[model samples]
Target: MKKQDVSKCALLLSLFLAASSSQLVHAEEPVSDTASNLATNVAEKLPSADMNSESSDINVTTNQLDATLAPKAEAITTETSEKASSEASQSDTMAQTPVEGQSLNLRILSTTDLHTNLVNYDYYQDMPSQKLGLAKTAVLIDEARKENSNVVLVDNGDILQGTPVIMAGKYGDHLGLIDLEITFQNGKWSVNKDKSHAQIRKIDTKSELADASIVEIAKEAHDGTVAYVRKQVGTTSAPITSYFALVKDDPSIQIVNNAQRWYAAKELAGTAEANLPLLSAAVPFKAGTRNDPSAYTDIPVGPIAIKNVADLYLYDNVTAILKVNGADLKEWLEMAAGQFNTINPSNKEAQNLVNTEFRTYNFDVIDGVTYEFDVTQANKYDKDGNLVNPNSSRVRNLKYMGKEVTADQEFIVVTNNYRASGNFPGVKNATVNRLLKLENRQAIIDYIVSEKTINPSADNNWYFADTINGLDLRFLSADKAKDLIANSKDIAYVGPSATAGFSDFTFTYMKPDQMTSMTSTGMSQADRQAIHQLAAKVYKETRSSGQMQASLPKTGQKQSTGLAILGMTLVGLVALFKKPRKQN
Candidate 1:
């Protein structure tokens, strides 16, 4: 062969090989619509160029290039296919065995402030009110339980002190509390005789009553009184009143007087004492040990049982799992501390150490953390849980699990929905990981029944700091809290409150010696009397005499007319008896 012909063949061979390799690369890759069209055009032109070539040498060079590259192209295609299959098989294996590391699935449920709505029925309206109740929440809890095996339920307190059921249980038959001797006279409810001084009926458990007719009557009266109060207040959220008149006719007024007398008697005798048994029954979960079992000592081996006389709390609040940073947690503690008022030591007047306006439901005594409130400083937040003063810091020495919590550190807060709501200051922005929509009361009940026991010992994670050496702080609570206050630490029973329903107590911050000088300075005798008089005036004004008269028995109408005629005759006799000298 000629040298130039050989060189031409070599160049043709290089061009053919390069074109074939480019086509193979394009075929291997996943092409888009545009790339596929470009590849098709190149494929069509390459075959035409081979057909148009008249040189036999060029055709021979192309044949040699094709033979040499065919095996290499086949090997490349096979390798690409095997690689894809291997990746698909690996992805399938990963889908089958997904277990990675040791991890736990935990759920926490919580409910709060249920107010004794065990059933979804409203006793006051005499109908069903599905808006609030444990019965409806129970269904949500059941659904959650099926999904998770590990679950913990907790209530955030305030389960007691609401609803007609609690009132009925506390006061027994409401009619029995009224002193008048009631009788059905002339087809109407009427007072037959004065029974004001008599203890007409002792308030006891409903179970003890043989004839419950009085209770039924009392329920009706209570419902009527509540409705009347609601109407007068112009809202359905009126606070419950202990005393109100059923009617205002001569006989009905006498009945009201008798009811007041009964109320006074009960107050003097301390009716709250009667409520202890019922309260205990409603909240029966005990946390601490009953009797210590010591094998070495003479003490009997008592069965391990939950028996602590702590205040019975209903389990209506569910448990909640929250992810909170240290800064937010500190902010929450400060908001909780807003419940207490900074005592003014310079002022001699008996000042309330705690803000009476702060609702007890908003007070959160968080467990599993040690913290204190320095009441000397003002709260960072206000009554509405809004940040008002950022400079003030009330929360002091906040620690979780014996370590100081850093701002960046994250911790779990087990709380209820009320606190978790946007209205609750620091908790508003918290990340809620889990919510078990369970009634706290039922959760506690179930825990007791399932665990067969509980240890009701205080975790001692929360307390008020005695930073001020001799600061005199005072708070008013139920009169029945005298004994509890006497036994408690850092607190002393100062004296009885001038207010009828509550008692006053002085709190000593690390200075028990100064407690002697901390006299109970609450509402003064004069102040109390003035308040009572004002309350009486308001009550009389709100409760119209005409409304009471309209409710009076129909049988009393004739008697009332007779009394009016007798008054007119007495006036005439007085006028006739008067001498004519008075005119001169």
Candidate 2:
């Protein structure tokens, strides 16, 4: 063999050895740039003279090169296949590993119309009650927080006025006085009068002492009258006054001349400027000097709290979750719109805005939907939330997330138990998914404590649509809401309303162009007329209850002719029965 051929053979052997080592070790690092450059240089250096040499020498060199490289190439192929399979397995394992970040547990809590039952006590019955109060709800809130890491709480207004303590705080000395006059006689205080022998007392219907017995009255004068006065004036702050006078006087009995000042001092006891000493000495009941305290035990005082209106308003409502279809949601919106009266476009002078019976708390303001109330049409529900007119479509163009709401679409509404129990319109058949056992106030407090902070602004997800003829429709709200209305984007302040304590604001209603296209196919004029008549009949039946008479005279007219005849007959009888007087 030639020296050059031998050198080529040695070089090929070294290349084969290197390739074998690389495959055996399964090297993952790529070949260095320097090594790659050296390989390229060696390939270029292969002599051109050798290529033109004898074909036999070229064939022998190629055969020897192929024999050495063939095994290394096969080993490399097997190792690459194994490596690829292992890498794919590792990728699969990595995919199964959980991604690391914060896990979210969001919760929303709401309380509405909590009428001040802070301690679960009924002042009227003068006993402890379990049915209502925020204290009972606090336990549920604590439990909720333990289960949920993230929480948001909100209150739905109407909180400031409910209990007797609240009323007393709001109205101070204006709670007027009770006057009782007694004369000390025969070692006791007795009713003093030159007229009738019966006990004389002047009591007003509003007077807190109207139910007080003679024994209670005598006891009231002996002491500073604090306990009696507090007992008499329970939850209401109505202006009431009473007078009692005594006729006889006795040296053994003590008479309080300035009873008003004495009672005032006692009633003011526990306050900053209370005269405790004077209050203590005001009422000093002696055994015989005053009437027996036990005698008045049977005479029960009228209920201290007025039913529903005053402090008697209880906080028994609970939070609930309602699942309903789009149709039900639309019906509810229509019922809420019933808070307004129907407007006649032809009669612009008619003030057909908010209904007189509409209550602010009863009118629910929902978020996350856009809708408009058509005032030209009658409400589907009456003021009592009864289905008065099924054909009436007051709720128009209801859209969720800018798309028209479909009848088949489902929605969830967070509402009070009263509303969920079918007390309110539109949810009579709704499915109740959940009921939060916590009281609303406590829930709100817990949510705030857990969240640390909250966003107070409304989402503005809904608004009234503009009227068809561009006529502005107005509604009444608190006069103080003028600032809010002026700043509002959807409503404009129109000035004070005819009703006191309320100001009127005009809201945008749906324009004719913006209204949803309602189609009724295969309906002839006769069918439409029949439907109209049916709707009218339903409205009259549900709303009026047949008590309304079409031919009844105006309320201002004379009620009956028989009463006039009876009055004339009585006057003639008196004249005919007149006694003739003789000269004395």
TM-score of every candidate relative to the true structure: 0.37, 0.35
Per-candidate local distance difference test: 0.35, 0.34
State in Å the error of residue 416, model 2: 1.4
Error of 1 at 465 (Å): 3.2
Number of clashes found in candidate 1: 17
Please tell me which predicted candidate would have the highest TM-score against the true structure.
Answer: 1
Candidate 1 Cα outliers beyond 4 Å, as residue runs = 1-315, 345-350, 450-455, 485-489, 511-584
lDDT of 1 by residue, 228-271 (tens): 32221011111111111000001111211222222222122222
User: What value does the lDDT take at residue 492 in candidate 2?
Assistant: 67
User: What's every prediction's RMSD, in angstroms?
Assistant: 36.9, 42.9
Q: Write the per-residue lDDT of candidate 2 for residues 499-583, one digit (tens) a residue.
A: 3344555655433222211111222223322332332333333332233212211111232344234334433543444334322
